[model samples]
Structures are given as C-alpha cells and as structure tokens.
Target: MIDEQDEFDEFSEAGEAEMDENKGLYEHVNITVDPKQEPLRIDKFLQNFRQNSSRNKISQTCRAGNVVVNGQIVKQNYRVKPGDQISLLLAHPPRLNVIVPQDIPVNIVYEDDDLVVVDKEPGMVVHPGFGNWDKTLVNALAFHFEKNGSKSDLDRVGLVHRIDKDTSGLLVIAKNEYALSFLAKQFFERKTRRLYWAFVWGNMKEDEGTITGHIGRHPKNRMQMHTYTDGSQGKHAVTHYKVLERFKYMTWVECKLETGRTHQIRAHFKHIGHTLFNDERYEGHTPLRGVNLPKYKQFIKNVFDILPRHALHAHTLGFIHPTTKQDLYFESSMPHDMADAVKKWRNYLEN
Candidate 1:
C-alpha cells in the first residue's frame, strides 16, 4: 500500500510538472480500453486502474468532471466501450496523516471555554493537507488546547471554517462539541458575517455589484475553481463587492460572500474579467488591464514581485457566540506587503 505521504509527493510533482488546457493545473491521466474488454462503468474501471482508490472516490472524480472518455467528460455510470481512448485530470491527494500537536504560536484575539478567535497570517495553511502536515493553525490549536488541559481529540478540537493558505484573516475555532455544532450551523445558514479586501484588475462601472455564479473545481485544473454562469453545473455561489479605492488601473474592493464556496471571490472576479492582483494561479500575475507601455509593464511586474501572493485579506469576521449568546466581531489589519504595494501605487500616482 502506498503511504499517504508518498501519494501526496507524487501528486505534487504531477501538478508542478506540466500545465495544459488553457493553463489548467492538474495531472493528465491517459488510458485506452482493451479490444477484448467488455462494457464496464467508467468509475469501476478507474477504481481497478488506480490502486488504493475506492468506488466512492472514483464516483466523486467523475461527478467533478475529471473523468473523460474520448476527450469528453463522462458521467459516473458511463459504460466504457472497447477502443475508447480515456483521458482525465486526476485530482490531488488529500492529507490523511494523524494530527500532532506542535508548539507554534497563534495570535489569539479572544478565548473562552467555548471558542477561540485567531488572527491567521499569510502563508500559513489552516489545516494539514497534502504537502503541508505541520506548522498549521490546527497544530497550533492542538498545543493551545493541551495547555488549557482540554481532552478534545485532534480532529474535533475546534475548526468551524477555514480561509485559504495565502489569504490572511480572522477565524474562529470551537473548543467543545456544542460550540462547534452551533458555529457550524451559523456558517451553513449564512448567518455569519465575513468580509474580505482584495485588489483586483479593471475599474468598475458601479461602485458596488453582486456576482452570482456556480463555483466548482476547474475540470481541467483541480488547483483552481471555475465559475459557471449558466447555473447548469457546480454549486451556487454569490459574492457582493464594493469598490474601496481606485488606482489608475487597479481597484481595491471589499467582498462579502453570500455563499462560501472555495475561491468564490477570486473565481467570481475572474469571471467578470477582473482577476485579483498577483493571483498567479488564476492568471492575475500579469497585467490584465492598463496600458502596455514598457514603464507601466515594468511597474506592474515590480509590484507583483513585491507582493508575492494574491492581494486578498479576510479583514473582518462576525458571529454570535454559541455559549454566551453574545455577538462577537474581529478584524485584522492589512499585512505589510499589501500595504507597501498600495503605497508604491500611491507614489506612482503622485509622480
């Protein structure tokens, strides 16, 4: 049996190896049906072909449109025919290792018997997943919980929601089962208030706008999410954005998510042709808007270098307390890199 770590390392290599299908980020798996083979479900065939794969996992891959037959995505139950050339994008492996407590510091905004509020910094992943097993927020929480003398298990320590690895922000972790259940309910019902600040390309005609689309993992690139406008595919998602500041070419905007789908803000803005600045995964690393003069291009490239990651910050989060039943709100100041980039743009505008 392949260990989880080995599987993740292979998946990581595959992701960094090549990119195709309009710059998608996923590994390509190709196979051909045997001439003497009988009809079988695509998912079943994949299960047999991919070692250590469960039928449920293969079904999920098919549903996500990662399984294609003869260059077309096939349904989970699609019957494979002889001579069919099968090609698909394989999804990355998940983290399956046991969570071990690490003595890492966490910026705790507030902590009570029921919960703890944390200010997560950039470049720190929220949980352990493939490629990242330690130095996570969860690992830090485990240490904190141990110090507090709580006997909660590793998996149920207190994680109700999560922000992206590169997106810095405020997050709440439940300390007990009751608190976790209560907080989870609020998030599921969209009762919690979350706000993010992002610098995106292009100028908006309106000061504020709402983006509604279906969001799902990109069929060709599992690394990113794709927005579906027709509502025919993916989960329903909504993001309302308001312009906070307008630069000569870029716009700083505030985003409020109505549905917390993965990459809702980034993918939704990209759908409207306003990808976030320095968001390399979605092609925001280059200048999408603005003049193409050598000086201007150089300036943009310099800004990208200064701000190494996407210009997105989860600045505000608010929710009612589960035990105390009191309303709570938390906010985080913008990171220094983003602040410095904004300052550079301001200087350029002055000159």
Candidate 2:
C-alpha cells in the first residue's frame, strides 16, 4: 500500500493545514483504473481510491492540479475512463516511524505533572516524520521523562501545537493525556494567544492592520505556502500586525494570529507584497522593495550571512493551565542570530 512516505514528484498539490508543516516533499501515488472499471467522476474515484482521504480534500487537490489523468490536469468532475493512468501528489508526509528517544538537551521553561514548556531552538523539528525520526523535540522530551523515572509512549502524542523546524520559539507539550485534550481544546477553540515577531521587507503605510486570507500550500511552488483572497481555496486565516521598528528598507513587525492556518503570517504578509527578510522560501532574499545598488545588495548579503534563515520567532504564548485552570503566559527572547542581524541593521542606519 502506498503511504504518506512514498516519494512524489514536484507537481506539488497541498500541504499540512498547520503552519509548522515541514518541507515541500510530497508523496506520489499512481492509480490505474482497471480495464473493467466504470466511468466515474474523478472526485468520487479518488475518494474510493484512498478511503482515508476526504471528499473536500480531493476537490482541493484537483483544483491545485495535483490530479493528472493520462498526463492531463483534470477538474474534480472530469470522468475517469477504463485503463486510464492517474497520478496524485500530496504534501506533509505522514509519520513513517516511531520517535526514538535521544539524549539531546532541551531548554525547559516550565515542567509539572501535566505538561512541560520548552524554548525550542532553531532547526529542531517539533516531532518525527519521514526523514526525521530522532533528535526532535519529542525525542528530547522522551529522554526527559525517562531520566526522571517515567516512561511514556510519546509517538504522535502529547503535542498540542508545533512550530516550524527553522522557526525558533516556545512550545508546550502535554505530559499526560488529560493535559493534551485540555490544551488541544483551547487551541482549537482559538482561546490561546500567540505572538510572532518577524523582520520583513517594505514599509507599511499604517502602523497596524489586519490581514485576512485563506492559507494553503502553493500549487506550483512546492516549498512555499499561498494565500487565497477569494476564500474558496484554503482555510480562513487572520493575522494582526503592528510595526515595531522601521529601517530604511525593512520593517520589524509583531503578528498575532486569529486562525493558525499553515504559514498564516508568512503567506498573509506575502499576499500584501511584504515578504519576511531572509525567508528564502518566499523570496525574502531577493530585492523585493529596496534599491539595487551594488553596495546595498552587498549589505543585504551580509545580513543573510548573519541570519541565514527566515526572520521569524515565536516570542509569546498564553493559555489557561490545563490542571490549575489559572491563566499562564510565557515569553522567549529572540535568538542570537536574529538579534545580531537586527543590531547590524541598526548600526547601518547610524553609519
């Protein structure tokens, strides 16, 4: 049986609904309609083909051009014929293996009987999936529990939310099932507060504004998320931003999400033509809104060297404690690389 880990082609379709989804790697599955197969709508065919898939998901995949029949992109209603070849591409490869515990160090912010909060560093994936089975935060959590004389099966468990592998920030892990359920309910109901800080390109006309759009995986660009203004294509998302500081060409902003769809902040800001600084996936490295002088270009390159990844950080998270029922808030200082990059920009303004 073809599973989530099956390697797929670059005709990318859709990604995880969550923003913290990993890379653009997709799983391709080929389905050959039997010679005796009856003519059926492509959407219906795919639903029968993958029982685990939903009808709405197939419809979105078709719109994204992930469904190909005999080498042609077809709409959801296109009829499938006998002896036809169909190729499918989907994103966010599912969990392929169990998470293995490692002795990796984790900076725990708080820990108790029900949950633990950690200040996750950059480049550390939140959980296990294809290509990353160990050294994840969950792996470290497993060791944390074991070292404390407790062993728990954390495979796909205890996580209430996730941050991108390259986006450093804070995350809360449920140590017990009750905590997971309670915390998850808060997140799903939009009761938790999350604040992300980003240094992006372009100056804003307004000091603060709200960005409302639907977020989904890019149809053609496999590595980036896309924002849909029409709301017919993706999940509804809202991001509120306030300018924290403004440089000659770039702006540092704080974002709060009403709906945490995949790449909500990145995609929403990109929709307004203000991509994040150093966000390679979204063309932040390119000169989108600045002068093209050689000296200015070289300065941007120097900034990129100091901060190699996207300038985004999960700085604050607030939610009611699952056990104590008390309101709790946690904050993390910006990482050194991003802080250093900000400092360089500041000094450039002076010099």
C-alpha lDDT score of every prediction, in listed order: 0.74, 0.75
Which ten residues in a row are the worst by lDDT in model 2? 8-17
Cα lDDT of candidate 2 equals: 0.75
Measured against the true structure, the TM-scores of the candidates, in listed sequence, are 0.71, 0.73
Best-fitting candidate, measured by TM-score?
A: 2
Q: Deviation in angstroms for 292 in model 1? A: 5.2
Clashing pairs in 1: none
Q: lDDT tens string, model 2, 184-290?
A: 54665568888999998987878999999877778898567788889777677789999999986889999998876667788888899899888877888876544
Clashing pairs in 2: 8-28
For model 1, residues 1-351, the per-residue Cα lDDT tens digits are 111121111112221221111111123567878888799988888898886655655665576455668878789889999888887554332233677889987899898887888998778877775567678888888888888897655563356666777887798877655565456546655789889999998777789999999976678997778999988777788899999999868899999988767678889999999999988889998876547544888888888888899999989989998756789988889888899999999888787
Candidate 2: stretches off by over 4 Å:
1-96, 289-294
Residue runs of model 1 more than 4 Å from their true location after superposition: 1-97, 148-152, 289-294
